[model samples]
Every structure is written in structure tokens, then in C-alpha cells.
Target: MGHDLNLNAMNYFEAVARLGGVSKAAEELGVSASAVSQQIRQLEQQFGVRLFRREKRRLILTLDGERLFQTTTQAFRMMRDVRSAIVRQRENRHFIMRVSPSFGVRWLAPRLKGFLDANPGWDLRVDGAPDFSDFETEIVDLDLRYGAGDWSGLHQEAVVHDFVLPMCSPSYLAELKEQSGDPIGQLLKARLIDSVKTHFRWDFWLARHGAMGGRMVYPLRFDRSNMAIQVAADGAGVVLESATLAINELERGDLVPLSRAFAVIKVPTYWLVCPSRHTNRRIVRLFSEWMRKEGSAHDDKTADMLRSLGCTIQEEESTILNRDIDDARQ
Candidate 1:
């Protein structure tokens, strides 16, 4: 309604919208409840719109409120990031590491503390980006990417050569077992989760086992391995993904092997990739070393779990999908 944007009102509104109540927003903002409420009322009047629908003390955003809140939240986040970047620039010994979103969220994120505690007086930023990072342009110090080592001119090390297997929730497995006695037949009838960006796919696994019958087409397809694994954990369907990434879920008994046929296809699951010039950074080497150890620990645990599940493991020999080049297309 005014020529200039009302920053204070917007900030107050964002706090209430995010916190779900005016009193909580006031408490966090170190302001009185009435002051917060006044800001909200003024904001509503300026826009000439009802922002929130009060439902038993919970502030539910209306359509217009939801739209404004989205923009405000993004703006605040951008401000925070800019501030952090500026602060890091003033400080020395800061490094940026890029990782695949799926791997970073499910696997590396939980184990990040070990590397930090071992090495202090340094700043480390972990970016879980879907796209492969352009090291030169992005100013990335380290990279953990999922793919076969195919990036030319880059010094790379296999973080862990991972194992892919068909895993599903306990409830889904029981329901799945009722459909067919034959393991292969059951998979054929069920919806298989296909992670399109991943090197190890459902078709490859099926073909390796010689169960290449029926449509062999997946109904549930996701771009990230973590997404497929999560849906499978929630009893959606059987997901063919890295057991290493699904360690927490497996440890929690959220997901189990669909069959006793354990698999260890030496396909590259994740790699510690960086430019040749950046390889010698002590921080990078230490992080890489820590990651490899963690990966080995994951493998050992996975192997023991598979054995407990009464599985007969087999290592498959096949070509792999090139990481940087092939993944860029998807």
C-alpha cells in the first residue's frame, strides 16, 4: 500500500507465519505480544487482505498469506547466507565441499561431526546440490559425488565401492510375499523404484539375475537414490539402491532385503573428487580419509546385516555409468 516495503512488519509477519503463533513469535523476537499483534494487523490492513485464519490458537495462512510468506522466508534465508559468506570471507581457513543431495542427506550429513571435531579452527560448508559442481566457478574445495570415475583431468578416489540391493519396509515385504512364492515373480508384479540418475538400476539388477521378463518398466521413478530409498522405507515399494546410504534405515529395521539374494556390484557409488590443484589441501585429505573410513565401517555393517538376513552374496561384473558426463544430462 506504501511506496516503500515495510521491513519490520514483514519480519514480524514471517516470524509469526513460521512459528505458527503471535506469542511465540514475540518471545523469539524479544517483543511484547501486543506489539507483534499490532504489526500483523497493520500488515493485513496495508495489503487489505486477511492473512491468517485463527483456528484454536494456531495461525493458519490463507492463500495470499502463504504466497507472501514464501517470498519473505526465501528473502530472509538469502540474507542469512549472504551474511555467513561475508563472515567466512573475513575469517581464514574456510573450505567449501559439494556433495550429491541424496548421499549428503542420508549418509555424509550424520558423520560430518567426526571430521570437524578432529580438525578445528576451520570453517567447512557442505552443499548438497543436485547438479555436479563446477569446481573453478563454484570455488569448491572438496567434492563427494555419486558416479563412476570418468571425469578427465580431475584427481578422484573412490570413497566407497558400494553394494546395491532391493530393499523394502517390513510391512511391504509381508504384503509382497503374499503375492508370489517366487522372488523374481513377486518383483515383477510389484512397483519397483527407479532412481534414474543412479549407475545401478532395476533393469541392470534384473538382467544380472536373468529375471528380464515382463514389462521390466518401473512405475515409481525418482531422480535421487535417497528419495527412492525413503519411499521404500515408508512401504511404498521395493527400491534398488545403495545399502550404505540406507544404513540408518536398515539399522532401525525400517527396511529389509526383499530377497535372500545379496548383491555386491562393484559399481562406484560415491567418489571424493576434486581438481588436481586442490587435492593437496590438508583439510581435503583429512576429510577424504575420514570419509573412506566411515564408508568401510558402513560396508562391514551392511555385510553383517545381509548375513543375518540369510542372504547369499554375489559380486556382479558390469560396466558403470560415467558420473560427471552422464549425470549432467539428467
Candidate 2:
């Protein structure tokens, strides 16, 4: 009995240990449970050790099994990355970027055409999902994510620090005015739409104005701000959303602020994130620059618009702290 290792058996052993069962590993591998079990048996026989113990009909890895699984997982990850990188180059997958769903639909989609048109022959693939990309196994170039800019070990820069305000269609505003004289009473009586995914909520903004425990009815709820904003613009309800995402609707007079005050959201600023190595890539660098410019322009236009609308802004105490900035005061 030579101490030679079987790669096929190693694969099956890795799957069983990682998934905690032979059936699951078999299903994922598109093989039968018997075959997976056979492989595990052969691996154990070759190594002359019990790799897993059956605890209450569930597989629990032994110390040796755990150590091997760790090595196998890392090896598999590296192989996948190498394969993906080669495939991307062969298929001309130039650059892949990911952004959050609402930001893609409400903010970036309209302005993406210019970047595509400017960069000829660059195959840029964009994915809009809530899940953050794990740069270890995927060949992602850059990420435009909405967060507190606190992702560790990655280089990130703030693209925009935006505020949230109550917005509704002009027609809805007229309806509210006709129904009541007190703005707070009118808002309480009207349908309040909630964007469930945002860090800022109707309650937080309402709390700022000392309007707590009102009979607020959220007849509608959405996971994306784009959907909520659109619903509000259709005169269905009033949505408290980021001013930057609702800029187009505001400019077109499709949506108007329900209040004279905007709550500055201190966290969840849009950030451009990437591994330090990827940050120096030409496409990543150029796109990051474009995003900053667009963000700055949006801020300028938003400031001008808010000034014209005769609105003031509010900021709550810091939910996330930065060492360099002054702490937010009430």
C-alpha cells in the first residue's frame, strides 16, 4: 500500500466534508450518493484513517478531514480563478463591473451610454445585484456599491454623500393640499410608501420632525428605490428616497418634495471599491474618475435645485464614525 494520493477521491472527500453529507455533494456533482460514498471509503482506505464520524446520521469531519478540506478549498478556489481569468481573456471579457440594483436602474443606467460610447471596443459587462462580489474567485474589475465605505483590505472612495426627502408627484401634492391644511396630518392620512432596502427609512426622517407614532400606513413596500420612486411619481403614494436617485423625476416635475426639509444620510454613501491591484487598471481608473465627476455634477445640480426649492437639510448624529471628520452634532 503506497502512500499515493488519489485526486478523484480527494475531490469527493472535499465535497462531502464541505457540504456535510454525501447526498448533497452527489447532487451538486450530478452523481449518485453511492458513488460519492465509495470514493470516500477508498480515500479513507488509502490514508488508513477515519475521515468522518457519523454523528446522529450527519457527517462530522475528523481533525485530519478538516485540515484536508481546508487545503482542497483553497486549491479549488485558485484553480477556478485561473480558469476564469483565462476564459475571460479568450472570450474578450475586457472588464466586468457590478452595482446595486436601485443605483443601476435609477442613477447609472441613464448615464451609462456615454461611457460605453466613449470607450470603443471595450467589452464591459455590468451586473446589478445586492450581493457584493467576492474578488477572490471572480474576475470583477470594479464595484460601485452603496455602503458606509468600510470594506476592509480593499481600496474604496466615496462617490456621493446623498440625502433623503419625502417625494411625490405634483398631482399627489395637490391632492394632499386639498385634503388638509396641516402637512403632518396630510402625510399621516396619505399612503406612505417604503423602500425596504435603503438605510434611511420613513421613520428616521419622520423622527427628525418630531412626528412619531402617527397612524402611518405603508400600503406599499418595495425592495428597490427605483420602483418606489416610480410608484410615487405615478401618484400612488409618497416615498422617502435619496434625492440623487430621484433627481430625474424632480427635474421633470414628476415628483416634488412633500417637506421643506431634507435629512442628510450620513451612511450608505455610494462607493467605488476594488482590490488595490485592480485599482491601477486603466479601465478601472478611468471609470472611477468618470463616476466621481458625475457624482460631483449631481451634487452641484442637487444643491442648486434644493436652494431654489427653499429647503433646509438635517443631519442626525453619526451612525458610522470616521476618525478624520468632525463628529456630527444635533
Candidate 3:
């Protein structure tokens, strides 16, 4: 059989091997089960080898099948990468940025309209998730990372320093005040929602406020800070989170600080990171400067808000200025 004629059969066989059953492969390929089976059989005949073995209704790939699958997978991935590169190169006006989901949704999304309005000639594409893009393979131009700004082979600039405080819904706070008369004491006794990624725990916050040895009651843990913040805003429980990430809720009067005490975790600040090669690019420089200005403005606003609430924003020594950029460049 000609190689061109066997291409369709190979595709059907690959799908069957990957999906582990003929019916599943057929459903995925939008074809009938019998048709998929027939194509697999034709491929086997053409190659003069059995590609899959059926046992207990499960289709397992044979050695030949595994080899072919590996080759096809790499080929498809390369094709996709090539196509993406071509598309990105053809569109010279778009700026690709990557950021964590919480920052993207709570902070950047709100201010994006202003940025776009100010720069109508430029188009923005944001990829928001927990996963950072690999610049070697992906066409990511800028990354907003929550870290110590010490990543090797990248240009890093500190954008925002995070300060965390105990926050809860306003109604919940009112209810606590009305019930126990001591809102902080009532909060310590109530359910505590926490993020697993928090730099400091409730015990740390309690200790800083001289309320040590008071254990949090019925703690609920979430993987993301935004999830805990959302749950706290819905009056589920008190949560310890960055004031920066909860700025929207605070402004909307959905969440209120439970106390006048806060802890600044100096290690994890929002950093603007980009490939060394792209650091000198005009667009990267423009975005970095804009981010710095916006971040500084937000810090000032948050500080003012804290003062209004009679909360003393704790000052933590930051290594942002101490870091030797000379060593970083090397």
C-alpha cells in the first residue's frame, strides 16, 4: 500500500491506541466503531504487524504501536509550534503576557481597559494560570510572577510587595460584633478559611497581634488564595490573604479587615520577568515602566486605605533594592 493511502489508517490506529478502545476512538474521531476497527486492520495488513492487543475489552498498544505513537506525537507538537511561531511573527502589534489567575482577574483585568485605551495601536493577549510559560518553546513576552525575583536567565523587576491581613465579609463582622461583642475573639473561635500557598499562617498573624496560643477553629484549606478570598467574601469564614489581591472586595465593601494588624511577607513579591533577549525590546521596556508606575500607585492607595481603617501597615525589609543586578545579569 502507498504511504499516502496509509496516513488515514495510521491516524485511526493512533486514536484507538491512545483512547484504549475502538468505540472511544470512534467517538473521538467522529466515526463509527466498525470503521475505526477496519482502518486499524488495514494499517496492520499494510505494515505486516499487529499494533494493538485486546484483553478484557481494553486495547493495549504493542511495541510497534508505541514507537509509531511517539513519532506521531512529536511530529504533531512540532507542527503546532511552527504554526504558532508563524502566526505570532505575522502579527507584530500584539503583546503576549503571562500572569497568575488571581492577579490577572483581580488586578490587571480591571486596569486593562485603561491601558488599552491609552495604547490603541497595540493589542494585548494575556495567558493567565498558575503555570509559567517556558520562553524557550513558548512566545511569552512578559511574565508577572510571585517570587523572590531571582530566576536565572531572566530580567526581573519587583512590581508589588504583598501584605496580608485577616479579612471577612462585612455582614459576618457585624454579626460577630453583635454576638460576642469582641469581634477578634469571635473570629478566632469561628471557622478559618486558609490558602495552602499563604506565606504566613493564621498562627503567625495571631502571634503578631499578641493573640498567640489561640488556635483557629474548624479550618478550611484551599489551593488558591483567590478561592479562599471568594469564600470569605461570601461569609463562609475569615481568610488571611494579600490586601492587593482583595482590593476589589475591600473597595466594594464586601470584605473588611478584622484587625489593625498586618504582616508583610518580604520574600514573595510580584515580579515582572522576561527573557534576557527580550529585555531590551521597546515593548518590554514600555510595559515594565507602566507596571512599575501602576504598582507604586496601588501601594500608595492601599496604604491610604489602611490608614483610613486605623490599621497600621507593617513594614517588612525588602531585598528588592539590595539585589545586585550585575550578578543577576551574569
Candidate 4:
């Protein structure tokens, strides 16, 4: 056995072990499959142990491989943590935040310019993805997550409670006005735009409103709620989505509510989450305060808008865990 193992080969082996195949690890590492295979072979020879056994085209890790993987995984994570900490300390004026794509596009992206303008010296990096940020190992300082606001081992504050209802373009509604006497019935008869990714399913909304039995064919299914909303605004079909994501379009007269019946799915509230230890960071604290303020303002405005539309706003039990401070030292 070699006295010193190659760190690079160990990394390749880790990637293969994590991904469960040489080809996948190669793609992720941006190297050829043969290259990754060679590295694994080198590592096994160096360690004097078989790391993986081939089984039905998949790389199955052996007992020694599992032990080595455990060590390397922790080591890489620690390395990333150390690197992130140093970079953050050096770039104290920068803040990294993560949010789901739909919220990022429809809600936060439009408001980001104002936030940046107010804090001229601060640099913000926003990542838009469905997955939550790993605060312990990743560089993300804060996250806007859509969930129950009950994630364990994290400091969380509810940013917004979203209520979903049927919405469609004015042109589409005008077209359907002659066909059906009931508004809900018209919506059910029209082409439906469904979001496959959201917990607020069209079936659930339909069943709640007593229209589940109606035979409606969804021609288009989108993975993102924002995309579904856009399709609805284009007069393509009727969509059921969060009012928060459609606020701008609705206010702009691009879309209108189809019915007064709305469902407040309590499981998917937007939350401002961060590691409990990082809540004390100056930038995190400032960003958290700003988000809470914006959230409150949006909620108030949305409630007013709903009232004007004669749509019932179903309120969820408040999940806000923090109170606004008169003065927070940045």
C-alpha cells in the first residue's frame, strides 16, 4: 500500500461513489468516463483494496469503499465550509441568498433593484432554484424556502402565506362567457394549465370547489408556477397558482381571478431560513429585516386587492416567529 493517497484520485472515487456510476461521475466532473475509471483503479491499487464491484452496469461500493467514502465526504464538506468562511470574511460586503425560481422571477426579481439601490455598498448574489440551500457547507447566507416553516435545526420566520385560486386572462374569460352560466363551470370547461411541481394541485383545488368530477383536459403541464401563470396570461388556458406569484400580472390587467373560492394550502408558506448560528451575522440580520418588512407590505396590499376583487382570502395561521425591532444594528 502507498504511504500517501492521491487527493485528486480520491475526489474522482468519491464522485463515482456518490453518483453510483463511472459515467455519471465523469459527466459531473467534466471528464471522460475512461478517465474517471482510471482514477478509481489508481486509488484502489494505491490503497491495496477493491473499492467497487461491478453489478448490472452499476458501480456498487465495497465495504472499504464505503468507509473511505464516509471519510472523504466529511473531509470535502469541511474543506468547503472552511473555504466559504474565509471567502465570506474577506468579502464582508457581499451576501448570498437563495430562493425558489417561481418566487425569484415573479416576486423577488422585480423588487431586487430597489433593495440594491437602497444598499449601494452591499453586493447581493441570488440563486434561483427549487432546492433549499445548505447553509452549513454552502456559501448561501440566507434562503427563502417554500414549506411548512418547521425545518429542524434552523431559525425560520414565515415570510408569506400563499393562497391559490383560479386565474385567467380577460380575453380567455370573455371567450368562455357565452358558453357557461357558472364562472367555475366555465373555468372547468376551458383548457387547464397545470403545474406538476407545486403541492397545490389542480385536482385538489377542483375537488375543494366541487368541480373535480368535471371532465377537463390539461393540454399543457408546467414544472414552474410562474410559467403556468404566463401561459394563463397569454390566453392559453386557466391556471391555479399562488396569488403572490400573480400579483404583478393581475395588477397590470393581464390576468383576473376566475372564482371567489380560494384554497390556502398551509403546507407551503414562504419562509426566511438560515442557520441558527448565522442569524447574528450583520448582513443576515439586515436582509432578514428587509424581507420581513417587504413580506408584511405585500400581504397587506394583497389582502386589499382581494377585497376589491370580491374574492375571499383564506388566511392561514400565522407562522411568523420573529418580531420587528425598532432598530437593528447592521
> Which digits, one per residue and each the tens of the lDDT, describe model 3 over residues 83-116?
9989877875878999988888888889888777
The Cα error of candidate 4 at residue 214, in Å, is 6.4
Structure candidate 3, residue pairs in collision: none
- Candidate 2 vs candidate 3: the lDDT winner is 2
Residue 140, candidate 4: C-alpha displacement in angstroms: 1.2
Candidate 1 overall lDDT versus native: 0.81
Show the colliding residue pairs in model 4. Answer: none
lDDT of candidate 1 over 96-192, digit per residue (tens): 9989898888788887888779888788888889778787788889889877677788988876756677889999989878999888888887778
Q: Lowest-scoring 10 consecutive residues by lDDT in candidate 2?
A: 321-330
Q: Which ten residues in a row have the lowest lDDT in candidate 1?
A: 316-325
Q: Of the pair 3 and 4, which is ahead by lDDT?
A: 4
Candidate 2: segments with Cα more than 4 A from true spot: 1-93, 214-217, 261-268, 314-330
lDDT pick, better of 1 and 4: 1
Q: On a 0 to 100 scale, what is the lDDT of residue 311 in model 1?
A: 61
What ranges in model 1 sit over 4 Å off?
Answer: 1-91, 262-266, 316-330
| Reference-based lDDT, each prediction | 0.81, 0.80, 0.76, 0.79
lDDT of 2 by residue, 229-304 (tens): 9999999998988778888888888988886744444334789998999987989988988888888887778867
lDDT (10s digit) by residue, model 4, range 113-170: 8777877778789999899887768998899987667689989988876767788999
TM-score-best of 1 and 3: 1
